[model samples]
Every structure is written in structure tokens, then in C-alpha cells.
Target: MSDATKLLAEKRTEFGKGAARKIRRAGNIPAVMYGHGTAPVHISLPGHDTFQALKHTNALLTIVIDGDEQLALAKDVQRDPIKPVIEHVDLVVVRKGEKVTVDVSVHLEGEAAPETLVTLDHNTLQLEALATNIPDNVVVSVEGLQAGTQILAGAVQLPEGSTLVTDPEALVVNVTQAISEEALEAELAEAEAEAGIEHEVAGEEAGEAAAGEAAAEGEPAEGASESSES
Candidate 1:
């Protein structure tokens, strides 16, 4: 929703893998513009600028599309599995006053009751809000909450003009009693025992392989020595 999310776009005439590769070589990102009952338009954007703008979740982009100014929201981004380079991006056209449904991160604030552990069941929740006024994040309080306490989706407060799209009864945060040191040690011991068993199995397999090789060599040498003596 910031002016920093503006994108300078260039219409892409070329298609296929070769064109996309060429675009990447030129330090640009291949992106698609769709949605709002419009045709999919292929475009290229500056790589570094696009990456910075996309740091925001559900970022509202002021795009210069085909010499016309249009507002859009980042719908999806495809990135390389092993590399940090982005592969493609999907943008959805939107109006300033339009209410769009998006997921916003829920951050925990304050500490729970002593000796209790706070577990977040949902990190983000879906909500409908204005395109130009999307909330950055929602904060949930865990102040002095005891074990077995759960916060539902509907119980969280929303920013102005925002409505929850997720199920109201869905659990968002759960506070539970912390595990004892003995329990943790017991779990670790079990894991170590399992690993030791696997190590022993591998050692036995290696020993068997060595024995087979030694027998194979001895048999050949014995036959050769007998023939030479005769």
C-alpha cells in the first residue's frame, strides 16, 4: 500500500522459454498481469526494483502498464528451488476502493503465563480489506494466558473496514503447559537409540561386503597356486 510499491512495466512481445531466458539475462523479471475479467498481459520489470517491492505481503502495486497507470496486487511469485532468483510473478488488477481478500500475518505480542508455552496454530489469517488500505499485520495478545487456552479467529480484532474471511471458530493460538526436562531427555534418548541401530546395521553390511571380497580373492589365488605347482 506504499508508494514504494510502484512498478515500471514494459510489454513483452516475445514468448516461450528463450524469450524468458533472454529477459533474465538482461536483468529483468518476466511477469503476468491478469484477473478482474481481463486478458493476461505479459510484461517485464526491473529485477532489483521488483524484488524490493515484493517484500511486502500482498503488496499493492502502482503499475505503468502499456503507458497507462493501473493498480495491481501481487497474487503469486515463482522462484527457483535452489537459487534465489525469481522465475515469474502474477499480478492481479485492482481498483483503489475495491475490497480484496488477502491473508495477513498474525504476530504474537506479550508473554503467556509462567511455565506455559505458546503455540500459534495459524501464522496468517484470511480477511477482506480495501486494496489500497491493506493492513501490514495483525497482532494477537497472549498476556498471562494459561495452559489449554485457545484464541479463535473471530476473537481477533481487525483494522478498520476489514472483515474476517476465515472460519470464526478456527483456532489461531494455543497456550499449553511446557514439557519437563526429563521428558525432553527421554525423547532425545529414543532418537539416539534409533540412530545407533541404523549405524550398527550399516556397519554389519560393510563387514559382510569386505568378507565376500576377501573370499573371492583367496579362491582365485589358491587355484592359480595349484596350477603353477602342477
Candidate 2:
């Protein structure tokens, strides 16, 4: 985990949407701090500082409220749908030695064996780690892995003091033989034939429309000529 980011916040006495809007208009975001079996605290945090602090996943924060410091982690953040602004935040109170479950991203490193395709079955892993020691990401190596090779969640090496909360037998990375272009095309054609489906061709539709117009014009001209002769 990264070092705790320090932020100064003010206790908010106002409630409701109007009050929250007013708080945001003043360049602060409304937040709620809860957990550890205490009453929830409503506060306002600086917009810029809070935004920067939350850039890190499972960021440990040291919130200074009324000169008293409390350690917390950013559990949830609400943002504007079309704007780059944070509307609200939820902070969960934590202690120094407490264990917390968090999802860590799985990063792939190295290359797989030649002529093989590598697929990631799981992109994140649930892990339990100390509140102040959460890992940024877990690395998985596919170095020279051949076809039919699979890496399970249990086979991954994690940071010290971290325990996997995900199922051990879950597949993480899989290596498979690459399919040739000819085989792929043939498979697609076979699927289309089995489905008994046909796609409309734009050029064919245009030609049929032109032919119908010509036949209609010819009938109209013959009728006019016959009426003139009569």
C-alpha cells in the first residue's frame, strides 16, 4: 500500500440535496464517514485533494477533522455522469492492524509461447490484507507458456501477509493454440449455413429496383400508344 494521504475536512451540519449542492458549489464534496460501530459523520472534503487522493485504488487516507486525525479508506465515490466532478464520497473507518478485503487488478507480464494465444480468465483477485498494506496490483507471468497451459488463482504468488479470498481453483490465465485464418473463415461460413440466414445485398436491391422501374415505364408507354391509335 502507498502512504496515507493527508486531507483536511470540515464537519457538515447540513443535510439533503440542497445542502449537498451548496457544499459542492463551494468547491467541496459531501462525504460520509462510518464504520467501527460509530455514528456516521457527515463532512465536506476539498474537491481537488479528494480527487487526487482517490486516484489510487484502496487509498488509505488520514482525514483531519477539527484537529483530530482519523485513518480511513475510500470505499465508494460518486461522480457526475457527464462532468469530471466528484459528487459524494464514502469513507470506511479502519485501524492499523485490521484486515480488509479488496480487489486487486491482475497485470500480465512477459510473453507466451510462439503460435499460442493467451487469454485472461480473471482480471482481478479478491484478497485480504492489512488496511495499510493493500497491494496496488498482482503480476502474473506467461513466460513461454505453451498451449493447454492454465494458471489457477492458487498458483499466484501474493505479497507477504496477503491472503487470497477468491477460490483457489479459479482459472486466471489460459494459453491456447491460435486458429489459422482459413479455418476461422470456414467455421464462420459453416455457422452461417447452419443458421439458414441470408443478408441483403445493397447492390442487388438497387438493381432490382431499377429493373422494376423500367418494366413499369414500358407498360405506361404501350397504353399511351394504344389510346392514341384508338
Candidate 1 — number of clashing residue pairs? 0
Candidate 2 vs. true structure, TM-score: 0.83
Candidate 2 lDDT over residue span 72-185, tens digit each:
998899989999999999999999999999999999999999989999999999999999999999999999999999999999999898999999999999999999899999
Residue 211, model 1: lDDT of: 64
Off by over 4 Å in 1: 183-230
Error of 1 at 184 (Å): 4.2
Instruction: Evaluate model 2: give its lDDT.
Output: 0.92
Clashing pairs in 2: none
